[model samples]
Target chain A: MSATRVTTPVQSVDAQAEWELAYRSSKLRDCEFTTLSGTPLKPLYGPDDAPIDPARDLGLPGAFPYTRGVHPTMYRGRLWTMRQFAGFGSAKQTNERFKFLLEHGQTGLSTAFDFPTLMGYDSDHEYARGEVGQVGVAISSLEDMQTLFDGIPLGEVSTSMTINGPAPILLAFYIACGERQGVSPKDLRGTVQNDILKEYQAQHAWLVPVEPALRMITDVMGHCAKHVPQWNTISISGYHIREAGSTAAQELAFTLANGMEYVRRGQAAGLDVDQFGPRLSFFFDSHLDFFEEVAKFRAARRIWARKMRDVFGAKDPRSWMLRFHTQTAGVSLTAQQPENNIVRTAFEALAAVLGGTQSLHTNSMDETLALPTEKAVKIALRTQQVIAEEIEVAHVADPLAGSYFVEAQTNRLEQEAETYFKEIEKRGGVVAATEAGWIQREIHRSAVQYQRALEQGTKRVVGVNCYQEDEGKGPQIEILRIDPNVEREQHARLTALKKRRDAAKAKKALDDVRDACSGKDNLLERFIAAAHADCTLGEIADVLRERFGKYKEPRIL
Target chain B: MNDQKIRVLVAKPGLDGHDRGAKTVASVLRDHGMEVIYTGLHQTPEMIAEAAQQEDVDVVGLSILSGAHMSLFPRVRDELVKRGLGDVLLIGGGIIPGDDVTKLESQGFAKLFGPGTNTEEIAKYVIAEMARRRAATGGRR
Candidate 1:
């Protein structure tokens, strides 16, 4: 055997020496030169930084191990769905907002339910009294869901609902809404954030226990496979985890881990991997670090594609694609200098686009103050338009493919995520790890570290730690204020609906839901029947909550 | 000898599931030598008031980001007042507008912190307010 040695090129060595000499003589900012996740950065990246294999790591777009992109033509074929996550006040008001966005060129619809609906509580429930229509629209029954999509044709438009704990019930209501619009389940297209695992790990919006929630998610997957083929049963989300203070790699690892766990559960439930896997989607957060966010998205695709094909033994190329929706990080928005959020959101959205997202939501600048007003939402939507039309970023796919820095960061993220996967496996997979509060503690540790860094000025959030200004004297921007009467009106409407509906039929539907929850019958079918029978979301959820008790998050420090 | 710590009951007293702020504040309070009791999600005003009374917390911090402060905060305050624990130093935080802050303050809240509020400021304010209350009550109740 012959021994081989590698050495740096003479010219490259001389360039490195000159670079070190210049670095020693020049002044640099006295701050950590690292990514938000603490990945160290050098002054420059040469070929030595990352050795990329063109045929292996950097494969062609739309091919197996899709690191570059999921689609071949990418944006040139079709721009990402510009979905603005808008919901607030009553269903009527939010419906008006939805129409407004659609009129202004929103390509998709994303609904954000109020806390009551998210927690599977009726608007008139005592626990939901004050919070009827605060954060998002309060949809207690199919009536509210119907009002939420009043004039908009559900068949023509794609919708995404960001509800986890009550995801099945919400999706049922949505399917019922579609039926009212003369849209069959087969033609309907949308996604439900049925990613319950993340709720226990980060969001804390979970309703049922872990085992029951998994059962419900698998039930949805099976039902959608047979019924709503185009519908994404679960949008495996990292957005909430990122908002909860996880680093970029942590978000990627935890999100993909949850996705794989779902795949495993589906397989365990005797469902073919290809049937359900193709419809599974992902949701990610685009934060301030531009290159890091882009690299994270790239790494996510490569990892998912490889895992789905190589590990899961999936033959379908569609199942290997990591289709994701990106939202600009809400945690990155600042209240100190509220207008600065506009710039932050623009860069973040651009990163998502450059990272090859299938859809994107640019957060409104005034979200830190309150729910976005019409004007603020218009600007947020216009940010995407500017990126698509003015910026012309969609002219080519994977523009940053060969950049040494981006590739190195992508490799680093992939490696870090693999390490986390191993650690999570050691802790007995995602569900067990989540139940034992390990995942939450890991996220909390990063969150605390990041908060400490921000407090100590090590992390320079513009207009937060560094660019100080008196917010009391800043330009007063108009903020959206939900009318206090929205709650009263929604409660009254719910009462009126209850009076008009068939009480006995609703009771029977809820009983059937309980039966389905107890037995092996598909819960989605029962939920759909309940939605049709005018049983409120809280009713269906309560029936299941009775059988499978509510989850109390373990106290993790 | 019993250990002395500033006991705080950090509760989310509404339907809002956004707990990033609440968890961060709880951690900060705990780090600053305060014993934080975080009653997880979906706590009603009655539940919060009962927990505060039972835990005997020196401070009650309600985190409401769902724009229901006008309705929820007053209910919590009324519950605490009805329970004869009005001196529990009720404070609030979340995506609250300035106008609502004034309204909540007039309704017996100590102060309302908004987004981007420093944890140190919150910690310092709690300590200072507790000391002031202690001084006013002659170090009793």
Candidate 2:
């Protein structure tokens, strides 16, 4: 009676609109569509559909809140630098591949160190067996580093080393090697996968415990800021996280959270945000969900910009910028119908380009079987080139920016990721969470769910669960064959290098590294000095192991 | 199939950080009612062999993606024999080539599995092989 007496036109209009929409709906196969993160999607999008504040959320490319890209021109000015993850056998062999990739138009160098090198052991060390130059080129000392980049100019080409626990020593080796090549650390431009937190969460290449690892990372940050200003002390990576079976949102959120933690450590170490943040970079995995991957990248830029500005109080625009390298997901590739991997890679690469990655590494078709052959590697490189040249997808910035679905999904994903970040913080940071097995358990639970879905044919992987042919049967794809003798040859080279080096000098250099590790001294500085003394990687590794000791992971399962 | 559990030792022999596959395989094998002893990250050949001997594992499953498979597998094979564990089936997995697999098998490593190898098949093989080995050993355990 009261409503009838005072009924407003607004109330009647609202009721009429609701009734019209409720009656107008027609039956379809499925009424609702959504992203994995539970973001609602409409059937279409237009210029008027986006809910973004242009100046606040997504400014111009290269501006604050760089949702479009970190650079104004982006790929229009230069296509992403194609860097293939290449290494195996000896430094001589990997060095050859380096030249090959460069000659074939690889703009950056990404080094994959063997187990022993990564673990800080020499080729002759008992633990070094089977691993020397098997997974990557073994660089045990300055001699190996020198051989690794022998013909390649360190002064010009930016190099990224996928080493963590011993990243400081490796950086020192590179600096010393650079000195030998008449290059200085100041002029070098590259990254050290010096992200130790992710090491605990995703990759298990950690040498020391979390506390020392954080210190080592900060040491690089301080040293690189002062000396190697052009170098990125750490490449905050989500590649391994995704490869370890994380969803896209987890990868984005966890990686940025790790990046924030690193920044906090750097600040605590007395380094200014502006001093080190400009050099901070990221490495992401471009998964099979093309649009999702693209949305993830755009959302990453928006989230990082907001965090750097509001949370960390970053002043410089460069401090807020997120320049990242994208690598197509290796876990996505199937060993069945190996050639189909090429198509998957192409699509992934296209997503990366559209996502505005600063650089890219497309997974080779044969990598699921073995380290890629030169021909297969070339196809991967060509995949990027074709996307940049032939495909006109990069003409516009955030081409899908205003698309209602993408914009809404991006927001939803960013929100989900933020929730995860809060959860990680509540669990006492990523390292603590990992130590407590919370992070591992979460990943394990998700992995189990995904596998169960696959098993039950709920998730359709084109060639896998459904439409499986012969179920793991196929004509074997051509695998990149490595010579078994490479290990023997690497051993001989290590022996010869040891025989020729000044034993006293090498011993002293290693002693310095051990002293540094035992004390609060910068390990990178001593490592550089050791490299000058021509100490082998194994010698340096042994010294550090004696002082810092190897990490023993707490078993979750 | 009320058989004795298959004791499988899952080992990472090198510094390569990729272990999802290894962990997944271990979990799957355990789900299939096998006892899996995972020697945590960065294990050497000596450690792997010692673990196998201590655990009295029926199978030693080595996962190496860091391309150190050739050096790692052969040395593990040698160590197993050195430790009088020649009875244990030394299997290999992860990014290994066909030709190298042949060479490794010739050198007495058990069968090689690649990227797409089924978790079920791995579990079944380990269970069946362990049963056979137990029969030969007169079921002392």
Candidate 3:
């Protein structure tokens, strides 16, 4: 809704006056011209908007600051990993889906655990009714984990597990699964979404309170730095934070703040930043704002690189690189006229690549209604493949580098994030602010702002708010329905596993885990040993809950 | 018409933590001049029912994103009936399919809003429904 003509039309020259007269007389549609996050944009931009110094702000890719990208060649060297997160039903069913993805040319594996497992509950736990395999694969034991990666090679394929609250337990099961495949932890490459601060602030999944969760993360960091060298111990995520309704700037600010807290924790535990820093990665949501999303990624890199090198005093270049994964915004998809989501996802995927992500996941068309069907998943994957193979935009690094609008947006987001960092520091760090409900309140405020705009018709979402469409016009799309029997079958597996396991050994190892939670010992060793002793995820999490107590969120608006 | 302010309890009745929609609707209903009570995450059916009874709310809205509504909504509904609050409007939302929306609407659900639903619409629906129910019951408490 902003006008860009600064000079008076009457006093301006002939061309300017004529154009201004035409613009004033023409009927412009009533809509707000802004980014997806409500950032106002002018009709046109000039040199005055962006004054970027290339050498200092954005050095050559892989050089100091690393603003442009992490690598010198970028996609010229390798395309971003087309990692569609696929998990539903039991482990065997999810395994078939994984293999099907691999056969269809997916680059990496991204496993999504069901909500029960995400909350550290077994399939048969009382809290897990009707939710065993609804959203993702229901994994309860090492047997389930083993079946998940049955034929997939642990040595070759890199897998990323989206688990946070019980990250150490899941990683232990994964490590033991690899061991059975004759692959030591040294060769296993993947990422575990071990970030817990966002869980407290947004996602609402947690195994323990703030203090114990940070301890578990640092414990996993220490172990993975030595044995699981290739493993990304923590994917400091902004994805869920955004999904929970945050602006792009809040997403970057809160994500990197939590990341800084992790660095502080590792340093407090006497671990070097360079030791665990390179293994630390990030995950973000690519919303519908093309230039703004690209700028956010660039700003994320520059901020993290400067913090790692200057603030943390890490000398390794690897530690300075801020590698990240990106997923198209699930909140952007609509249930009405769902086919339009394919185009939305394609554009968002293009933004991720232009933003220089190491991996990307595109949300399926029908995901607004259910977990994507096979055809929907294929279309989502093909969107990425089309971007990788057919699109020539990736041949250059940070292709939007010098664009006036893009650079200006990048600087704007960076400054806003810095302001937030100071505010977070004023309230303490990420964990303390989260505990005080400051971060949650801030994110929810922006979410409500966006929703208000959408309702007011200022921000138009095609097929949702603006375009008129009848439901009977188009053919009904098939939706994926997880069989209700999956829960029954999962409960049966858990029952059989409990009967088959060595009860005494599991009890003793789980007791060790409980003791380890209280002591100064690293919890991962106990977790791995417990995994070997056939302990279920629920058993170990139950012990941790007993030792660490639980977290109660302070109510906020 | 009775000048009673519509009382509403927004409940997240399952393990999922997606409270954006719940909180947004709660805020919008509050804006529309309704008394609102929000039950935070991880509340069982009995807890929701007790909260509704204690608060004396006219409507109980359940928000669950984990696809547990078939089991959860009925359990909460039965618990409300057990507590003798069966007539309270029981509405909900999540990633529910169109078929499930029809099925649940037929099976004692007031209404089920899905993704992309405007919070204002939810508020208007509650106000109108409460007025209609009160008029039908001859304005009895």
lDDT by candidate, in order shown: 0.89, 0.81, 0.91
Tell me the tens digit of each residue's lDDT in model 1 across A198-235. 99988878788999999999999999999999999999
Q: Which digits, one per residue and each the tens of the lDDT, describe model 3 over residues A7-37?
A: 2223347866687788789998787888889
Candidate 2 lDDT by residue in tens digits, A30-139: 32354432245565543334456767766888988898888898777877888888888788889999999999989999998877777677777777666666667878
Error of 1 at A474 (Å): 7.4
> Candidate 2, what DockQ?
0.55
Evaluate candidate 1 and give its CAPRI docking class based on DockQ.
Answer: medium
Tens digit of per-residue lDDT, candidate 2, span B115-141: 766677777777776667677778732
| Candidate 2 displacement at residue A401 in angstroms | 0.4
Over the stretch B1-141, how does candidate 3's per-residue lDDT look in tens digits? 877999999999878888988988888899999999999898889999999999999999989888788878888898999999978999999988778888888878889988888888898899888888889998753
Preferred candidate (DockQ higher): 2 or 3: 3
Clashing pairs in 3: none
DockQ of each: 0.68, 0.55, 0.63
DockQ winner between candidates 1 and 2: 1
Instruction: For model 1, state the Cα shift of residue B71 in Å.
Output: 1.6
* Chain A alone, TM-score per model: 0.97, 0.92, 0.96
Candidate 1 stretches with Cα past 4 Å from truth are A1-11, A473-475, B1-4
